[model samples]
Target: MANKNVIWCDEKTLQKDISGKIYVVTGANSGVGLETSKQLIKQGGHVIMACRRVDAGEEEAKAFGDLKGSYEVMKVDFADLQSVRNFAAKFKAKYDRLDGLMCNAGALFSGDQAQYTKDGIEMSIGVSYFGHFLLTELLLEQLKKSAPARVGILSSVGHAGNAKNRYKVHFEDINWKNRKYNGVDAYCEAKVAVNLYAMELGERLKGTGVSTASVHPGWARSNFGGSGVMMKVLRVFLYPFRNSITNSNEESAQTSLHVLLSEDAPQHSGAYFSQHSVLYRDKECRKGGWPMTSPNPHAKDMEAAHQLVKLSRQMVAL
Candidate 1:
């Protein structure tokens, strides 16, 4: 059955001329973020490329050739809370209206040894969830002021966990201080928390004209896993069938573009939009056609959602 709500948001469908709109795309130098930024700029939307490495962002922007819109690079290390604060302040000082914010930066460490951000939070949660939490809080007023603005969270299907093990955020030991650490599990926890946050945020922002949604861009081919030995080996091993297992950056980016640009997006605030990978992992992940999908059971627990938001506020001092 086809999903009528699934609007294949490609260049052809996204025909709106957003000449003066401004968007912020974190991790804009590569992967889905890069493609999202590229497509937005091509459609006359100004993008603030928020990256950890400004130089890399500058390089990518330069290679983008001539665009209908414009872009500028800004530095932000999601692992550092202070850096997030600084970035928010800088963004607010320069731009009055933020048309959209794409929380696309993520961190995935390898091995059982736990990694910590500069702020002493677990690295995966810090970068993938908390930093965005704080950044959104700081800029929320601006989003509200902009009216009709949007916030797109780039989450993952890993949050759903598997039949054998359902993922949960360990509120008591979120930093993995007591239990043996697993980076993959930590990533799952962060992603689930992100969905919960989006749900809570959407509820709170109702009628504020600032809607939010969590989207899975499929298993996109991106520089997510750092250049580690395991990644190198996995890349080589999967090279032959990569097209079947993973999505191209552009294909994955459609979900982001949908939440950011689609007129129908606001109606589905707090929803989770997914891709072909959700139905058939063996099929090639193509661009667009994001049908609404169920997330982890935890994502729909209003108590958990509210609790997470409360904890996040306390952690970020919002």
Candidate 2:
């Protein structure tokens, strides 16, 4: 369930001394990313909005009113593993430290047929899970140096009570060759992976002061999900309902920002937050048993996320 007061903060709410602190937000050209970046800029923080669209990204940067805070746009195509590595390397070489990383970009219920990323993985799997996983791994050092850094993975509430996901933990065929592809299912599974990755990364980054947590942004009425006819029709009928059912992007984004900036949750690693507070991680995840309902419940299966990392390494040839 979503908290009634999930959105406790607004653009004028917190004055984070981000003037010197550097942060990177992906999919920053629109929706929640844009709002989050705007809020940060309003507080005098330096933000790098990474988006696949250069023109849109620059337009977003220009909207900050003043480029004085070092607001800039960076290129990042999440579906491309090489692009993910390029993004991290580019960031590391230019900045001394990074204070926060909000994995704002996501692949939502796209109705498009199952497609592989440049790396040959399913589109949703590549963009939503593998891409962010690599970015976080490559940027781990700077995040640690900025001690007590926050790594927030934007998850979804739809992850609960869902099993029509077309495919199981087909760890063997992550690309989904044998099973039919369901865009919503893929998105849900990817979100589940996002939570698992957070837990896995928490263990690997222990003692580094880099906190990790999964956050549900609440159903955001944003421009995502583009699969095909069936999806298109569903979206049309769901539009009116969606508007009322989901919170605005900015409103939904508050939960993610809270996890990243809240002093109260400094030690909230490996936890999942819905709205502004931690919620139950499904009975299975809590009991050390695989959430049969979740596509991938084993948080320790970081090996899958790592495979993307390996592909990134090979792409960057690092």
Candidate 3:
């Protein structure tokens, strides 16, 4: 199901000039994050590349060539809450406004044992969901000050796993403290949290010029998911048809670009977007597939979304 009903987006989908606009992209030193930042810069937009490794980010930024827009690298480790807060404070102090914030950094753990972040929270949920939560919470005011700003969250089709029951959040044992550690399930649940957060955040921000949405970029080949045995098996399985089955980094970035730059995206603010052609923006800039409902019923649970926000605030000490 993850492979079906998806659209393949290209450069033609987004041709608008965004000169002078300011955006912050997490994990921007590589993969989809790098591609997204490159395109935004090509369109004359200013980008703040937030990365765990500042040196790596600087190295990549140097290779961007002479582009219409510009970029600067900042450091933030999603595994550490203090780092996220520090980045937020520095950003607000340096920039007058923020037009967009892309919560694009993510990680997957396929090892047998559970891993933890610097804060002791489960690694997958900690880095992929909680850090971004704290960053967005801290930047809400700046986004409001710069009305018409947007938050684009990068989700995954794995959120709606290939399992028969789909995926559900384990609120009672969110940190994997009580259950057998399963890395894939942990990743899926973390993604579900982000999607739910986008839903609830949209509801709370109504009438505020800032809007939010979550997107699923079709499975793209990258150095993500690590080199655990499970991942190796998956790679070997997909290697035969990886080209036909997976999207390239540039192609995977289309959905994110469309959601952030499309003029029609505001109306669909609480929705989930997938990589299917049906959800793409057309030549006239009208909505194609978005406002697309998430396949997971649990992701649509408004009550759960609210509870998640509450728990997240407590976890991040917000």
Candidate 4:
């Protein structure tokens, strides 16, 4: 069981000088992804900001003028499978090694409308899980060549079934084609898939010197989940409690930084982490208080993770 009193270390305390390492951070235009890129640059690492909007990414990269390392903005629209392939091809063409890959881009639609990507897959699953699955698969060789590399998948606590509407990956109806659609459920299911992908990938890359981990960044003050009118109204009502309930983007990004660059990450490959600590089962957590660091049973089910990997490969036509 993880200690309830565990405190996350400040990002500034990281002293690992990653001077020549190269990293890729998706959705680096804003929020946690942007902050993560900044921290990596501060530690003397080159970063590729994989974004959907090249113009926005270029503008955002300018803010890092004083940073020690270099940065490049690459276009990658996760909603389109072709765009993902293009990004990977371009990256492989330019870079010889990839020290780290952060699957940080994600979205949540509030309304009941069903949205599909250019690939004709559910928008949430397509972008949050399938797109990342394809991207990581394409980059596996580079990561292995780099050796001792890391992949961090940004998941969410909602995957733990703690939300008002619980969710689990419906293998038979992954895209919600057969059943009624709920955007929140679809988002949670996609996150579950992301975590499972990390688990299965970690196992497959056991001896390749490349490691993977899934992380819950906690509720952060970001533009995520604000796409719908309902979400906007809720945000307005919850504005007063935002400071108390949500973490700053920088703070939310620490777990990802720890998993990607910390010396301790290798030993915990395939693990799920929150607040810079390994998550345990809910029953193993402290009795009285809510176990923020504990992962739900679904996240730890190896059987389900394996199944998800097989299904994902087929879905992406890999």
Candidate 5:
């Protein structure tokens, strides 16, 4: 259960001067990624907007024209593993240090039917998990060079379970090649993989001064699921309660910002955070009756994380 009374931080609460810091944000054209980039720029951090559409990224970059920090648009289509490699190569060629990498870009519905990437993996898992996995791996040296660096993966509460389904990663059918396809389930599985990846990465980088964490930004009114029929149906069904539960893009970007800039963040390496608090593996209640964030059991399973990493490396031929 999530605490409805959680105190949410905003751009005004961020006061860190990240001057000379270089950060990368995927999907920086819209939603939480865009807002996160804005806040980072305002805090004097140079940002690289890694987007699939260079035109859209360049257009969005104009909004930060008068901001304290600057941003450059780079083309990166996560659906294609080769594009991810190219983006990382171009980044390495220009910059020697990477202070932060926010794996924020993700896909939800794949229209009326299931889809596969160029590499023959499920679209959702391929882009959301494998793509980010490769990018992070390619940039690990830079992140290590800029020790004390951070990597934030945008996960979701849906990874824990939906209102009617208890989501779990199906190791046997990780790509849904032999199983029935359900967009929501596939998305949940991908998020779970991301959380596990972050946890494992944090463990590996423990003494390297690089920290990794996963974040549930909470539901926001964004084009996340795209304008698909299913998304339209969901929007209509949840319309009555949208205002009470959904967060604004700025608000949703807070938790990630907190992990990236807060003084207390590094201590919680390998953790899942929501509403600025560490989400434990088991549910706990505060003295004031507030529900502390709790990650699903699968997200905390170290053995599963290791297995997934091994499988992911094999899938991407790393």
Candidate 6:
């Protein structure tokens, strides 16, 4: 069944009538986020680059001049709960409405060392799940104001079954005090949780026209794999495979734009998609192991999502 109705976005086609629309892009200083912002501005949308380093964001925003989509550099560090809070507060005060929020920031580590966030959760969970959780909730009212607002999460296919990520969330032991930390696998868990949260959020925002969709940008030759002596060896030795299998930043950014702007996206809220089309995962995803909206073979844990919200509130003291 070759479907021909799919509309894939091309970065070069920088001509969308998004003028005056407010768009918030997390981690907009580099990689796909930067690329995505460039195209957005070129097309006439107002872009607010939410970044950890305000200076870097300013420099990048300036590079695209008389930006069809006037932009400003806003500070937001996903690792720090306080920072996420500050960003949301400032954003709410500044923007009357939000047209789109692109949760395009994520990272990967190679070691099994357990890292904790300022909020006391595993480092991966904090930035990828809890932090975004708080940010989205804070700006939810703003999204409502924008009605027809969209949320795009940059997810990865790696969330699929892997020996490292099979840990059934021991809700009682989310801190990993009982299980040894596998950084890579822990990352997968957080991303899976993001998709699940999207499901719950979809139900909440249904009539408001606030849509949420997750995206897998293939692979990109980016700062995804942190640099270190060990990673150096892996990057050099595996350079051939990584380069060949991964996508360039240019091609990868379009998927996010497609989701944020395409007509098909809003109607398909709560589902994951890539390369501009809906993605259907195995039936296992419906079983109760992972959270809802995750393609993983797990049941949608509505309770867990609620619990996660409670935990985040306590950790950030929000």
Query: Best by TM-score, which number?
Result: 1
What are the lDDT figures for the candidates, one per model? 0.84, 0.69, 0.83, 0.81, 0.81, 0.72
Ranked candidates, highest lDDT first: 1, 3, 5, 4, 6, 2
Let me know the TM-score candidate 5 reaches against the reference structure: 0.89
Cα TM-score of candidate 6 = 0.84
Q: Write the per-residue lDDT of candidate 3 for residues 1-318, one digit (tens) a residue.
A: 234434544445467788989999999988889888999998999999999999989988888899999999999999999999999999989998999999999988875688999999899989989999999999999899988989989787777654366677789999898889988889989999989999999899999989899987766666687777777898999887665567677777777887788876778887887764322223221122565766678888999999999999999998
Backbone steric clashes in candidate 4, count: 0
**TM-score of candidate 4 against the unseen true structure:** 0.89
Q: Give the alpha carbon lDDT tens digit for every residue of 214-245 in model 4.
A: 87776666778765777689788878866555
Q: Lowest summed-lDDT stretch of 10 residues in model 3?
A: 279-288
List the candidates' TM-scores in order. Answer: 0.92, 0.80, 0.90, 0.89, 0.89, 0.84
lDDT tens digits by residue: candidate 6, 189-214: 77767766766777778889899877
The list of candidate 2 runs beyond 4 A from truth reads: 1-5, 10-13, 66-68, 109-112, 163-168, 226-244, 276-318
Tell me which residue pairs clash in candidate 4.
Answer: none
Tens digits of per-residue lDDT, candidate 2, 1-318, equal 333544565343365555787888888888878877777776667888989997998875675675446677899998887898888889988998998898888876455588778877787767877788788878888999998788887776655533332222445556668767777777767776777777667767788888887777665656655456776786778776554455677776776676666775456676666652222234333211111123334433567555534554554345
Best of the two (3, 6) by lDDT: 3
lDDT of 3 at 70: 91
The predicted structure with the larger lDDT, 5 or 6, is 5
- 10 residues in a row with least lDDT, candidate 2: 285-294
